[model samples]
Target chain A: MVRSYIPAEFIVEVDHEKCRRCKRCLLNCSFGALEFKDRVTPLHEQCVACHRCLTFCPEGAISVEANPLGFKYSHNWSPQLRKNIWKQAETGGVLLTGMGNELPYPIIWDCLVLDACQVTNPSIDPLREPMELKTFLGSKPDFLEFDTGADGTLRLKTKMPPQIAIETPIIFAPMSYGALSFNAHKAMAIAAAEFGTVLETGEGGLHRDLYPYKDHIIVQCASGRFGVHAEYLNAGVGVEIKIGQGAKPGIGGHLPGEKIGEEISKTRMIPRGTDALSPAPHHDIYSIEDLRQLIYAIKEAIDYKPVSVKIAAVHNVAAIASGIVRAGADILYLDGFRGGTGASPTIIRDHVGIPIELALAAVDDRLRQEGIRNQASIIAAGSIRSSADVAKAIALGADAVAIGTGALIAMGCRVCQKCYTGNCAWGIATQRPELTRRLDPEVAAQRLVNLLHAWSSELKEILGSLGVNAIESLRGSRERLRGIGLDALTLDIMGIKPAGR
Target chain B: MKNGRAKINASGIYYRELNRMIREAIAAGEQEIELIGVNGQRYIADGIKQKVMIIIDGVPGNDLSAFMDGPTVIVNANAQDGVGNTMNDGKVIIHGDAGDVIGYGMRGGKVFIKGNVGYRVGIHMKSYKDQVPVIIVGGKAVDFFGEYMAGGILILLGLTCPNNQSIVGNYLGTGMHGGQIFVRGKVEKHQLGAEVGIQEIGPQDHKLIEPLLREYCEDFNLDYNESMSRPFIKLVPVSHRPYGRLYAY
Candidate 1:
């Protein structure tokens, strides 16, 4: 075999004195980095630094660290650039990556700061008062008409559109059952059910086991239409039409045939070991009118369930969102450039879409300008790290925020960025039976539940400090935000005042 | 009134109300139902998971029988776009010409069109276990026929088209991966998509299509012998995974 130019990214060190000869780390290493004949040997080249072995080690014997002698250091030609160039020179293929963009792009969420009530306006204590975090996702009427009966009871004259209520304005983003394990999916489902939020069944259909939790599930229909039968459409509380993912905009998803096991095959409604390719564009939907047809067709199928449209935050996101709303989508899901994915081209994931903060600000401003802000609720996603980020999104006019990587972190993902390799050591992103069994659904569910509960509490605290009792009051209240280090143009576009102003 | 079949005049009724009325009639134990006027009404038998038969007189609109399961819909007139879209366990019979995107993502259904079909017909039709979708057209078909088809059978019998004219259009079965497309007439090599390969109909292929052709003849009142007189050619995907080698890993 020709000598490979690429060097190993990590170095595995085993302290022989501390080793107890149990070889627990050897068994737990999913990346095939450990081998034992007479003694446990480290194949540092295969190590992904997932920390699974480190965490599972019975004794303090193993330590994996970044290779200090990675490359000849050059400020202009960084190690990453040199590595990528060398990789392409060897493989002549697109560099595939898992998870969100790891680029050092400016995070607007960090640049913007929230406001707190001072002496003039007294802040309320969440402990003593009831703060409403509950929000509904769906289109709302511009005005409500009530009829006063002779008995003095007021009757609602206007018909209300279908809405799915969440206890908190935080939801689990779309993560396919096939991409993750059954245990991971179950954990998210149980957590969403316990938390009274929703989890999306990413284009790869809902599993039969998740049917009982259908009330908190939002079934997605992408270009591929995998496992989307009439029953699947009506199984969830809402249906989402996935147009584009933020990680890889303007491209299709290809779940390789290797990942198509018997169960995934059945769930996706394809033959075993066949590539499930979702075309970039829904062939039938060539225009906005065609999109409207599909939206209405789904509405007809599900009868009264709300339909959401998920789109990557492209340059013209505001216009696209407007069209989506006009095309009868009840909920609009906006995924920013920093969105997570099971697998995507590294180039596209880093360079394709805009930030969620900018997209949310633009779409909300446009919808409000057009007087159709009430036509559909907006859910912003892509690297919403904390409850503070969720509050900031709501203040920027998002009705809710979706968390994907954060949720996976709650379930023990170490952000190894090797999900596509099907060797997720934490068992959160892999489908291998042995690795998947590592994640206990009940335990992972409890962790997710705790994370959401903590975030909810923090949201309430943020709301109380803002002198608002309900999350709705904070929605679209841009005056409550101040741009810290953002330039004048950026602040103007986001419609936020400077920190001192 | 005829043979205990419930009849409804869908004139000037909205699509939603008409569908609701159809459901109500079915719930009321109407075994076979018929509608008199269905002009431009969309979603005729959409998502109706019943084994009952629906007969319509006037032309139905787009997305007819979409996501419909276990219901047989017979249209007396031409059907619009999106027929049998993502359908499962049902049958749709369109008497006249049908529009684009017919049988899209359809699984476990049979759609028989008596006349011609528009572009992108039978796109992404998949099969899972016992559910294999089938779409047969008696007349000519336009471009992108069976594009991205994953599974099931598609037969095009262009018996009504002129001898000089092409039976199928360009870029046939463009991204097809796991299905069979049968054409009754000759097609040029350039007309075929790069992902598909043309093969002479084998004995097994003949055996499989014979029963389907007989059923199509029965539905459209055509001569089975005459439909089979012309030599047939089968188009299958070159590889089950056309884009497998395109990626690095």
Candidate 2:
């Protein structure tokens, strides 16, 4: 399979005059892209632009310059498209990448404009007032039962539907130990515990070290059913039945055997060097009734633990969400096509599921119209980057939002999209002991906590500007949002009005 | 069943309530319990590590001992689907025939089935450290027996079969990665999955097979030597990771 290779997209050039010849760049590069021939030459073809060697160079002598080699440009045949084709043609393999979808699709979050209060309705001062981000997510009952007390006063029913109360609605989304590392899981768990939120243990099974964070973890029972035992199910605030993920909606996830190293072998309870493949659909659950059966099975196992169903934001997400609500799901998590993954095929990542904004709005409107909005709290996820995006999601009817790529960024991910190679220099997505050891749980956890705190403060500020003291008031309040540079259809589907109306 | 024990009259389709009652009783320090009218109430003894004895009179539902650890569950009648799914450690004794997919992903436990099991039995079962799952089915098994089994022991004794027309069904042990399947009687060449092939029982295998069979015969009230005298073959995965060749770099 000797095929012609394309020149590297970005080439690292070393200034000869200031080279210093310390060889720190060659020593720090995990990809071995830097060659120390005469004075630290670079085999740029292997460089994934991880920014590791460049960032650690003691002497400011190296720079990564984007190659001027441009392909024959066509609207349909861009440089990336040509490069991808050439790479596949050379390797004859399915192209694997990481991080969120990088397609230039319409970002509705940027188009959404948040409304502010004026003259008659003055904005609340968040600093002076109690800007409560406190949220209770669960099924809210329709009517209250009043019983006469001994004092001849009416009292409501003593018991109410179960609610998962958290200070902020941001949950640490499920990222598996095999895909990432134990340190990453610890970081997420530590951050979640500090932030008074939940951290999910993606179907790779909870590491033994994370058992201490049991109260803060959400164990996922996906199709693989790896390392799932009675204690695994019980050791969590909730159980998430992963029906599908957003990156590759219909396809399953395959954490290659190379990634299933020593610690992961014990954590996932599978043999070392065995692929941790999550089947696309659960063989036990073939239909909606089967889904209900498994859901109840988990409920039966955990008793009263909150059970959530995570589905990709597909075309019929509303109808599917209705069925999920009817099936007694306390929470429905919708992941858009832009959702990140450790490894996914290029085609599915680029074109598969729908956007989270439209899906959230549609499901919210459908649930409200069907009068089952209170039955399940909607948590939107995909590419929720900033607190303003979180506010937009809340206004569009998401009770809470989850972040994956944003969390990785907080943990020092440069979005190099080379995570599937198991050579992540940032120590966030790789499982190699050397790379994994580079990530300090304490430091990453503190950074994540700071990011979440900043986002929470920004959320409170946005709520105050909207004249709402609590996040609940802005929930499903589509009138508080206006669409900018959006088509009429998109605006209608999103349940928002055009600007200046 | 025992003194100062708890008993639940599970007559309806309220598995949640039944499980809650079982949990409360266990939490209240009741070790031995009995459920009488257990007809298709799924997840009977799910996700519990308490050292208790649960006795069931009737047919328990699907996923009988799913994720169960440490408890000894005795099903007097037949057991249904998904017995001992991803089980950690426990003992499940079924007095009668069991349904499909028994011991699915069973990590560590002993599932003694007295009758024929259905499709995909012991699928994706794995062993971790010293925790090896052991399943002994007395009767014949249907299609895809032990499909994609990653670890543990699967024994199928074709005791009640009329004739030897491959007591096991088609596509037996398909995609089996790691595990040993012992079946009585001869299986046709086409009946085997791609990743597995049958070989004569060796002396080293006898050590592993003898004790498990002795226990199975003891539980079913059968002659151990007479059962062992019959022709037996062992099914072992050609490789630990069978699909490794397809997608490896």
Candidate 3:
């Protein structure tokens, strides 16, 4: 099928007088979009318009010219496509995407809509009403009892260790240090602390600047086991072992050596200029039993701090999650296939794992059925676009929701899909000093905070309409969900009945 | 004197009593402890640093030796997953079956299992000269047996259950650059990586096995002579160079 050729969105022009022909731009471009014709570089029509050539030109000869008159569309699409075109125009860089399948596949978030409050139940205004978003992430005691010591003073016998408290259920998902810029991580940390939530330092070790936000941070220990030590383990309120990521299921992470700066090198405890590779599997763990050993080891090391196990939502994710909970994890962080990544193979990102919505529903149902739902708290992350997705996730079985790509979007990421190149224009995904400076942590943090506040308000509104005052009440409450335009098989898998049935 | 004995009386629930008991044991400075009355309590010896000996009579829960250091955990019954995870220095000996990731990211110490182990036994077991870790499996293991093994020694005796003939799953040594693996069977359908070299276990090989076999038999009470009678195969890296033939440059 030969489609009509469309003109490039961005055309590169080289200044003849300033052209040095060092060929540095050609060497750096992973994508073969640049070619040398008579020792002068020419941009090919296949360019995705990442603008790396323009930015890296030391001679200051290259300039990008956008076509004022956009290419004519052969097939007329919906209003969403038009909006996307305008969005692409606003940001000259190719759409930088995080999180899963955005193609017009059926979104379960839209299928499960939130009901607005009516006259029967007064809708409390968020401005005046006190909406509770506090969440506790840890095991809860079945019953409370008092034990009398020899001294006759009463002490709680069945008290559980205190859980890390969050003023909001929303949290920043773990995006590795190499995947996003240091400034981006700072933004997330500052914003999370300000919002009384928590931000995760992905598999990457916590930066020195982020040490102050220790109370609001969750450090992750992954398969590579990078930068993990007594201090790193004890630095955060909670520690998470990253079993897998949503964007690339069954695959480990590889941070190209070029991205490893001095600070990143120090923080991660890896040699400078070495490709930081996370092995596909953690060597110590061979089964569910081994997972338990690691869980306990971390627990003991940190004096019983909350330990979370993060896994991608695969075909048997429910069963795997059940095993993880049985393995003694305090929290289960499920990343749906559509989750975003700083750098993942295109094949893995597009073709691995199930949707977050389905995985969450199935896992919740499985856990509840097995009577182990209370063993661990579930935090769902993938492509949670709006507040509606958050509400749906909680209703489907998640105790809370985590935002990654959405948070990046809030922090001026245009989803240019050039993160793999390490020349991010928005300064969110690159390590280059000049590029990274574009994203100011202060401004970025404020934007993130604003986005989270809006989502929190929307979540409260949804809970209010469902006759649930607290976010906790909405967790695992499948009664509020109904399938729409989905097949019988999908509906069954999701453990929900079709709408109007 | 029997001190630091933590008793758990549940199958799946991780009660506060168990946590308190473990905490008290640590606080009391008891180096060696025995956890009795355990029937699959999750996170049994989680993150314990004290040089302790935890002898579990019944089944222990998940994450048995997470971040464990300088201790010997002996599980009498079948154990759950994530054993010896990120363990710097320690030894975990399972009398019965062991779950997945038997020695995941184990920087130091050794893990010995008397019976069969689950998948990815030595997934990322790296060695730093004097800190080389080892995992000796008495019985067969599941697939992806030694995926991404950078260092350490993984010994799998083809002693499968009476009903099965296979010792390990397919892709036995994928992405393995360093480390030595000793398997007993012919490894017929298994695929090995380019960086691996396979050879029949000769007289010289038996010298290496003598000490490991003696230790395995001593720990699990097996007949060393009977175990050594079976045919064995040795797996070594193709070259001493760790980063051999990965890139064009």
**For model 2 chain A, the run of ten residues with the poorest summed lDDT:** A1-10
Winner on TM-score between 1 and 2 is 1
DockQ of predictions, in order shown: 0.72, 0.48, 0.20
TM-score of chain B of 2: 0.94
Model 1 local distance difference test score: 0.92
Please state the error at residue A215 of candidate 3 in Å. Answer: 2.4
Stretches of model 2 off by over 4 angstroms after superposition: A1-4, A146-156, B1-7, B28-31, B245-249
Q: Candidate 1 residues B185-237, lDDT tens each?
A: 99999999899999999999999999999999999899999899888899999
Q: RMSD of candidate 3 to the true fold?
A: 8.6
Q: If chain B of candidate 3 is superposed on the true chain B, what is its TM-score?
A: 0.86
Fnat of the models, one by one?
0.64, 0.46, 0.32
Residue B165 lDDT (model 1): 72
Real contacts retained, model 2? 0.46
Off by over 4 Å in 1: B1-4
Local error of candidate 3 at A6, Å? 12
**Reference-based lDDT, each prediction:** 0.92, 0.86, 0.77
